[model samples]
Target: MDQAREDWSPHSAHWGAFSARWNGATLDIRPYEEDPAPSSILQNFTTAMRHKARILRPMVRKAWLDRSARSERTFDQKFVACPWDEVLDLLANELSRIRTEYGAAAVYGGSYGWSSAGRFHHAQSQVHRFLNMAFGGYVRSVNSYSAGASAVILPHVLGGYEDVSRRNVTWDQVAEHTDTVLAFGGMALKNSDVASGGISRHIERDAMQKAARRGAVFYGIAPLRDDLPEEAGARWLPIRVGTDVALMLALAHTLLVENLWDSAFVARYCTGFDIFERYLLGRDDNTPKDAAWAAGITGIPAATIVDLARRLPRGRTLITVSHSLQRAQYGEQPVWMGAVLAAMLGQIGLPGGGYNYALGALGHTGRRFNAVPIPTLSQGKNGTSEFIPVARVADMLLNPGESFEYNGRSMRYPDIKLVYWAGGNPFHHHQDINRLRRAFNVPQTIVVHESAWTPMAKFADIVLPATMTLERDDIGAAGTDPRLIAMRRAMDPVGEARDDFDIFAALSRRLGVEQAFTEGRDTRQWLAHLYEPTRKALAEAGCDAPDFEEFWERGELALPSAPDDGGFLRAFRNDPLNNKLPTPSGKIEIYSKAIAGFGYDDCPPHPAWLPSTEPPDARRPLMLIANQPATRLHSQLDFGAYSQSKKIAGREPVRLNPVDAARRGIADGDIVRLFNDRGACLAAAAITDDVMPGVVQLSTGAWYDPEPGAAEHPLCVHGNPNVLTRDIGTSRIAQGCCGQVTVVECEKYTGALPAIHAFDPPEQD
Candidate 1:
């Protein structure tokens, strides 16, 4: 018979379709007709699927079985393969024992955002549902790494998190109405290239092009010039790291002093301006937040700051603050200050004239689409109500029963004995690898459901082989994307690997909860059940969509278009009192009284400048910034061909200014050691003026590979920047991660470079 051709979409924000050419057992993927030229991220899907690092069979760590073995030596231990039935039985028994010995609250479900895009097979949901059914419950995590601070703080300032995600002005509105776009952290093109579920079209680049064509000025205030596209004609403003809040305060001061602020709008629509004004004009503090004061802190010219402040209220201006700013100490200030600046401009509800916390961070920033909710596996209820911040995994593991403040609530970490991780890799996401490694050894047992042998897999007591997206049938739809694409099983599962749904279901059967877990529906039936709602919504909107059988065969269901709304906050702007927000005052809280009552000096009532944590030595003054890699989604495809191509000297590339490099006697392609009090890491230096003099950029997501005997200051052989980053909360109020705070000194490495072993799987004895 002729080879079967099927359509599929990979998990990404710039999601594209592909045609699978399968000849019985072998499969090949090509770009579909709709997306002729697929994105780089999409093109590497097959390479990742067929990579050597793929976990082909279920394995168990020898240390976990041997009572005498040390858990700290997990990296050196070998794995042995086991049958599915045997592994499931072992997992079920251990789970039951843990519950009986301690409690269901002792089980920590470590699943995170980076999982299968298919709503049904989403690892977080699948694991949560199984745990809820079989066991009493599991300790869950709150918020996400993308915008953890914004997720918690935005609701108190604005109405809720939807204002940041769904209520931003669309790009078309910005193009037509806005004259100047001030991007604080710059547009992260690489990070925007992919999404969670799937993307039918990549509109970010086109939207920027459109705005540029319409004569909108783009000002990128970041260390790197390439933060925004060259085509956008963005004027690069190099400001000092962690000094954004200082600059914003200065701008507000200038506006207030020059009588450029919207006093009428402030009186009518905002609260707490008097308190903020007192601080701004030196009434509270003897030091006025003037242009000169900001210049001293931000390293920007006083005249330029004054000029920008004057120009902001001239035309329709939009101020965008990247989530990266809030990943530092006192992180909430910049986000709050950005809003205060926008409110001063009298553009909170105007089309293209407000503060956008995450504009181009994701590709679907301000796009309009049908509000079709994807059906998720029902996680009935948590019998045990215990949780922690997502970034507090290490803290929870290390210091159980420790009290911490988050969003005006005091919570204590549960004493966890078993860690059941499904999708996410904490080794890549968490800060301070050495601390996390220590915490990893504290748990009695660690279970991981992974497709590849990630660093987390190496540390696992039981490693369950799971199928990749390409090896399973799934349904995908990103939040802002209008198309629902079918993800067909292009090839058979590699070795004995199975889908997460099957693994959870089989485990559920072993635990005597199969019916509860599966709800009497197999994978195919589940997919059909999930699609029914979308099918009905499409039909009601006068859009043609086939049934499950035909949709699976054809491979996509596009939602019907609706007339564009003016902007996200248009309705609120049109009518304020009647359409009041969820806030206490029903107006923007420039100075939140509730937050003031929280009594967190770290986060004041209004935006204010707070110094970042200082380094031990003032001489070693470079601030190291660990950003997201352009080539991979976190650490998902670090082993892929495309991601590997970006590596410098077979190591993670660190960008530094030429002046700084010359001062340190570092040349391009030279191996450099970035070290501080926390930890150290080795990276290949790439000398360029793209970064500021006092700042160095090393993208995160490199797998953590520590040197064997280097315990004092454990050196990460693989260029994982988290090894050198500080693990602290943004503030007492939000308690988000301060992953961006690190001061380091870089020097040329003279020692022999270690071979990168992060990509290789552990030996099987």
Candidate 2:
């Protein structure tokens, strides 16, 4: 759709004409670089972005535009549309007031889906910078869009985000080098920011195929899909969703019992292997579960488990882990265990041997992990009171008397009275969406910055209209890719919206701390200051040919190189100390010394498996796995031409297996009520054999619309799944899964739905 149509001089654009195009109507297009963007002001932020330009090679033009465009956008004709001035003023005042009243800590930053093409000007950095500027300091976020599970798991596992994204393996080499590609989450193919980087893999895939034809084995361990081809012998393991940790435990037990583990590698590159092995053997009965036991639950034959476990690409085994497991109870554990499984295979520093979040995040910088020391922003940072690991949000909220130790101190829950949020819709996150609504009601003031009526926005005491990249400029620095691009404007403010950076920058100005946001010349000057570290690197290679200055003129900037890549790997191996992991032990923590101080010895130093949410009521049968659809990012698919594409053949329906359907007397296309003890939702059911017998699946992204009689709309539930499906208990306290595992039964709908149903018909013209 034409998002702009400004009357600029013909000479404005590098292209011949600035003639506007159209989606449904001609949008105002301008000479994108006129306005100066500013710093972001969300209390704390972790959002990640899309794009078109000469920066991309022509070999993938359409794919690049399709992948990157609309990293930032607006909800069309929904909610109250306001003029820019009113919107900006109201939005800014509300945010400023909220921060003053509640303190920056009360605010949460969020933006799950990716939006920008240029790596730097994307969500997390831009949003966080804005939030940090406005509120002094907001809670910092960790993890990338993909391996969020690993993010939570690895901090304790490999150490931190800097460690994981910093891995040296080019995982695509797996399909070519490994004899067996044991995988999980076949249901998820694309990485969260997969297409945004302009990396396509058909050519690479062909190479993988040639390697596969020469006798490579690929096993996709996930809930659905026999979709893997026969040539690759891609066997789909039917481990029930939320039960993955159990399966991993079983596999680990088998590997240990059969002595399939690489004992030599265990000693050389990893620590705590001896301790993990002892725990798995269950010298303690706390581990009531084992491989033979896991076999019964996972439904894969015990022999197959043994075979796959033993055959997992022995010297060159490539274990690919998925981020989805973290969406369930014990979310962090599985990814932890998955990484351990790879380490046990002894493949970390080897070619074609390692754990892949996916193929493309291979940082191209060719930078070394370090012969160099990391810079510390703080000297002796104390007094940032301890908190629970981020994955344990539910525990922080609902677990009675639950407390966690952080930074050498045990802390009780603070009486959080206010919530000031910018850049995120919590409805798409945390969990038990309905439960959260009531939880949110506890806050005295809820302030949010938004461009649309996001589910999280509905609960706000004040809604601020935030900019959509077009209204203001941003100097973004994405951690995912090694690029630092400028976000120049393409259109004027659509309505009351102003860029988040401007809102925060101006708010800081009002609060009498101009220097807080000041480096402090102007947005343009700030960009130059931010790029100071990379200038020499970019200059030396001529890769900075289109230097940031030139790139900024065109609404983008390219970086010189990444901090680590393939070459970095070989060089680091030659000198392990210079390339060693950034862990306390400076080696893979088959056993983390950090946890010994924390007192959770039962939890292995390496990845140890635990059961899914325990106390599973035998009466409540099937597992509910919330999966992502490629069509949309989180709950963001609404309000664009993209909306029309999400419908399966036109409309989406909750999918369940036929057997599970028959038991409940549910039929196809039936508007049935799906309810559990927590809450209820009425959705159309499409029973399919594609799903596991004991599992049901729903694709998230529908704009949550609440029932009409709802005393008040739960902005989080405008189609919010959480309203009816939230946790009564913080089951997956640390491993994630705050959203999955609700037991709901189906019933025919008796109530009337609005013109647009909570689950609407597939959007179309």
Candidate maximizing lDDT? 1
TM-scores, each model vs. reference:
0.96, 0.76
Candidate 1 local distance difference test against the native:
0.81
- How large is the C-alpha RMSD of every model relative to the true structure? 2.3, 9.9
After best superposition, candidate 2 residue 356: deviation in angstroms? 3.6
TM-score of 2: 0.76
lDDT (CA) for every model shown? 0.81, 0.50
Q: How does candidate 2 score on lDDT? A: 0.50
Model 2 lDDT per residue over 33-151, tens place: 42121111110011111111001100111111232441211121123433445544654665676667766655545444344333333444555555556665554433433344455
Model 1: how far residue 61 lies from native, Å: 1.1
Clashes of each: 4, 49
